[model samples]
Target: MSTVHHLDPEQGSLGSQGSVDLPVDCGQARLLELGYKQELTRRLGPMTSFSLSLSAMCFFSFFGGLPTAYVYGGPVAAVWGWVAASLANILVGLSMAEIASSYPVAGGPYFWCLELTRNNKKYTLIAWITGWLNVLGQFATTGTLGYITVKHLGVMWMLANGHVFSNAETFLAYAICLLLAGLVSSVPAKRIQQFAVFSAITLVFGGIIIMILLPLCAPKLQPATWVFSSFFAWEKEEQGIPTDAWLFLLGMLASQLVFIGFESPSQFAEETRKADRTVPKAILWSIIACGILGGALVLVLLFCIQDRDNLLTGEAQGYAAAQIFYDVFKGRFGNGAGGIVLLAIPLLSFFNATVISMGTNARMLWSFSRDRGVPLYKVWVVVSKRTATPLNATWAMTALAFFLGLPILFSPSTFLAMGSISFAGLYISYTVPIALRMVMGKSFPQGPFKLGMPQPVINVGAIIYMIVSVIVMLLPTQLPVDSNNMNYTCVTVGAVMILVMGAWYLPYWGAKNWYIPKRHLQPADLPKPPARTLRAKHGGASNGASPSGSRAASVKTMPSTGSLPRVPSLDSQASPPYPSVRHPLHRSTSDDGSEMSVYQPRLQLPDIWKQPTPPRLQRREEPERLPVLREAPGKGPMVPPHD
Candidate 1:
């Protein structure tokens, strides 16, 4: 039971005014309804949230993957494939926005799963699976970003020198990239906001610069018939594929990478001000904006292709776009200038993407740790006292990225395999909660943001798209796969699922106490307050008080009531007005026959306010004196302590 205070008009007016001045109360009230406190600072606005999502998507950086699309389905596949993927991703974002609006927690999809299946016996198990998969997917994303940065740097190095380095040198470069990303991520949040803004500026203006330069500087552009009508051509015939259709379908997977990280804004929901409204807009706008920008960039690159045969023959060291840039700009601007400009965009874009990925991974890990869903929760959940950021979780994610990227030293194909796993894990995690919400129909809680009548259709469409994405991601990219190049996505995803379920069900692991969400006790569910007996103010043997004629403090009792009072609005300025219940102070007589009051610490409010009385007090005899009254050197009399 809680105590409620009655306020006069002035006090009530202050409360009402405050509620209007700062609307965080509304967000907090929604969180309380979902059984959580506002643990993270709400400092991010809509632009900051959108910037982070755009940086995560990093569409310009993913131009490296365009070669794969071109190889499988020719120029037409690269264009149409991105359009189709963007449409599907928009549907996914909308469905997620509806759910995010209702439960805007840092746990994001996992928290949604918990709330959606609140009454089910298996809610904990489902939530656990969703969380782990999300973590793994984030780790894979970080690793992939690190790997891309290293590979792009290596290409720049090759342009500088004439030879390729050994596997050891490549590993060192990857480690350096991961280290740099971690350092950038550990900066203060204020700096991170600045970095996010800079990233957005660079993405927009930098993409425009490249698009303009590529067309103007090229000696001769590809014909429109070839660029737009070459849909049925298969550029890669050495893979020993049985049919063109299978190869083209495999090529479509590259489009999936363009919009992979659109869900990043949802991960920062706890930190964003007005999250219910901001997050959905951020998610939708980032995807649509990236889709438009990315599609335009692809068309510009395809039109500027000078020699398709040279690019397809691995002339760019698996980054055909780099070869196109070198060919176009080297003639007009010189090799040194062209190489620097060409490499700078991806390098900067990858670095930006890496920092955003690290931040997202740390937030997700911290949220899971707060719920006791991971090992070593005590260490992982520690927020820095100075910055209020999860420093420990940030380093943990960096260490995991380093460990995951170690395979690049042995097999370059490992990066591709990890990318596939990331695509699969994140999409599956997304599909589950949306599917559950669809199954719940009208019973599901609709948040402030809704898809209205087309919600069910959108939800079902998103699920089917995700299912196809997962299947496509797990398939081998090339025919006649060998040990080194075989896709390990299936094996990696299976291992993760098995590990998560085993930990959940195993008897040795005491997960139930920590991982399960507790059922919140609302004010109405509390026990009623007991009746109190009132006696005459001057005298009563039943009421505990000092002996008659002694200097005793008067006790004021509240009128007895059956039900606990409603809790006052949190925005109210006035504290609850309960009667003061003071205990008798002990006195000791000195040798000069002067009495001194013994010091006693005041009691604090109990956990449950509506209880009949406070808990039994334990008396202490310490000599740490608290002054009841003090007499100044020239004051008339001793003054009592001010309230």
Candidate 2:
């Protein structure tokens, strides 16, 4: 049996009121690992496999890409917009791979900034900015999706039979959908993953069917004078600028919008098994696959549609693509079946967006709360012990998203306002971490996942994309001179949000109290200490004399007699083998109050920071559990300890 060791409290350093000794069994060494004990069971299986991965890509891509293309660019620019977006996603994938690999945790960039800067003041401020912005950014994105789903569904209902619900129909639909999505998200994480797997599979099959059969069914696919052309080849207003250059740039902006949410996997990295390797791969795989497949689908549809006039006007409608799809499949499968299949894509797209939105927003909220940035820290951050999910955070984001989306439902004109402003806010949030990384230079640590390519290349690419994305996201879709049609939606709303975040920071979440980097690894995970046997020096216990040796005495076990005798008068060499110096009035007590002379253990200052043995492997040993958050009531001023 292994013997357990502990500090001798009597010989240890003393505090003002009490002596300090290393804990023999405080139960804290494994706290980090066991803290999530309840939440671990909620994780999904590891073998998500390639099919599911591809399906996930399709779901996210369709939700993110299709809406942007159909609404702003129409068919021509939409097709080319996908191409630009694909290339941009590659850059995004590379950057994220580095960051995700380095910090494979749930909090995403917020956590990354904290670790990279090691709680430096400037970096702490940046992290604070990133955390709140990212959280709010995700909510805004969810709101945008809510807005789009309601608008599209309402329009479809209106066009079908003119018995559309009412002017308030979209708002009511959005509210219902948001609430329902929240409910789906509130289910345990394990269950949500199971659903995700099913939705992902359906999403992929739907995409393949629509893309493959729809274009083939279009009438006059190879019509005379309907040859393929670049996005810029078609001119709408014949503005002074060169069409190709302007359209290409504009298309780049549109495509970037589609690729904005690709980092959803990284946000949930902690929940992912073997995330150190898988999270980065997931981000890369999804981005590459989506870019390629989505771009191709857009290209095919663009080339097949020759009547640009009808495509742009309300005549083509957004569902014109769906019609093209039905046309191709109906000739062979029968009109009724084909029409249903064509409609399934949009229906699936709507649900896909909802699921993705719920999952991403929930993770963001969980991340923020876990870091203590948000209010209701305990409840919001608490992962269901059974499901390993932050259900409270999910529900909260859903409620907020529904509230934000209420405006769009009441006034169709405000849809663009809500969406564009949300987009701007999200991008601004994204830019915070990226900009700080660039400016912070060499101060940041290299994370587990890194952009293997040269630093200059990666940074330049990111900056370029950021500039373009911000420019496009800020521009208003329309300028109708009404309050609802206010231009530069992103800029207007984003400015207000930033100001609000800044204002909040001053009162409660300031620079000093903003970031506190707790040790993340449990004792079992920490490196082990080297072995050594401490030896006493001259004039020490082993030398048969203490520094003030006067025949140091004991009441119980005495020094061995092999090398010396207790009394000099009785033997020629009469010195104790081991001695303990004692005061004249010393009355050392042993266990059971029997007196003994034994030199108690003392720790070196260098050993103070050494990792302790974990409770799991400690046999009978255990440590005390500390409160997760240690704060006071009322609005007393907050300050970080000097350590």
Candidate 3:
């Protein structure tokens, strides 16, 4: 059934001093390869497809913080702020797309830093700092989401009945949300992808349905005069702020919070299939579409607001757009049924955000762990054999997400305030790696994707965003710095605090435990040897090289002893040593017009040993020459060589 060959002991041998055994594959070597392939599969397609794009839109829609922006800069600034942010968002997306194309790994900004850094000692310290800052940034985003989730649910409950949730009710709601979010993300990576796809689809359509149904169902709709120009027009002087200053700075700063997640997809690039292409596409599509949709929906609602006083002054007044929609529905459609449906529209988005957010967070945590940045390297870096998901990272993020949500019970604004602080921190965090990319002249490994833009164009885009982000981060949330000012100091302090945490990785701690810088292992780089089986007794190869058909007739066999070719073949003759199949790229030793194994383009080891030795039997020292026999007896054992 199969070809079998036996060793000839008299022919030749491997000839070694110690025992030789076949190499084995085990441990992280196996784990690394398995994880690499699994992550590749994840990046192949968008988990949420178009819906993820919509969630991005919905996020900015309810930035209730805009009122604070309005309180500081007036309505004129708020309108123009959206314009600046939209353009800035596109630039930010492109810069990140470039980074994703290069590194295309889960480590995101930090990994990019690791690759681009010139000096390991200095750049590594910087990259490590950026890594944990990213971790904090994730926590900040989760807190922000928690605040929004609680705020909206609270508003819905109030509108349904006429009461706010008591202290106990508030804690229970946050606890429930945290637990549910954790459990959902704790599932497998593929499962998360599928769920994200479904969530993205639902949220995108939900917004579309709301936009269509709202204007159609409203009894007294505004004419074109009121809808566009008038709604966008604002009286800046009434708000006591310079229109130019307000529009340029206040609006730009506030809008950054909503656009924060535009680069979220990049965190999963390593897990993405064809990341260079898919990640950049997903990011650009999400930002452009979401930016347009968010601006349009807010403007549409601005047209429909009948009473500005009631809109901004209600007990739960920050959510004027949502409340206005609900009020209109109740007044025109029926007894509160239509209004409930409208409220449910955005709420559905939170559901999608809940799952996707956890997925992103878990991926970031997993990437950090793989680099040994986290405390538990072996356990945290492990991917679940069954699910191929980072189970430990998921569990850890879940615990952290719950703890972060705890502040909500003490102060309603705690989570919200923390998010505002975190938003700036994240923007600052984003700028560092991007600045590094621009300063350091390097690129990531090429995959199926690349930013179609010229390098200079991409660099300029990154630079503009960096300048704007810094300017915006410095703006006061509640301007005029009175006792009631929003204390923008928190953002600055938080960012500084995050950087300070890097001190642990300074000379004493990081240097001691950190060995030489290790490159992330790729599949092709693993240790591998020629697939040859040793003969049982002779120790020579069992199946000596075979001529692969076309050159078989011209191939000459040679006795093996780990040495170079004994003699060269003449013209028209075949080469010896069975036409070596090893080291295909290397030139064949044959000097004659003899046939050899088809010369492969790739390089390989030559069949001849670099270091040769005498055969095992010949290695024994020869005995001194013995005396000659019979004829020499008379001379009483004369030396043998005389003849």
Models 1 onward score TM values of 0.77, 0.69, 0.72
Q: Which candidate is the best by TM-score?
A: 1
Off by over 4 Å in 2: 1-76, 155-160, 222-244, 312-320, 326-337, 438-444, 476-486, 505-606, 609-643
How many residue pairs clash in all the candidates, one count each? 0, 19, 9
Question: lDDT by residue for model 1 over 304-400, one digit each (tens)?
Answer: 8877878756446767778788778766666645745666976888889988999899988988887778999779878776666788999999999
In terms of lDDT, the best-performing candidate is 1
* Candidate 1, pairs of clashing residues: none
lDDT of 2 by residue, 125-168 (tens): 66777677777667777777666566556544544544556657
Better of 1 and 2 by TM-score: 1
Q: State the lDDT at 622 in candidate 1.
A: 70
Per-residue accuracy of model 3 over 11-62 as CA lDDT, tens digit each: 1111122322111111111223222222323423654533444453354344
The TM-score, computed over Cα atoms with residue i paired to residue i, of candidate 1 is 0.77
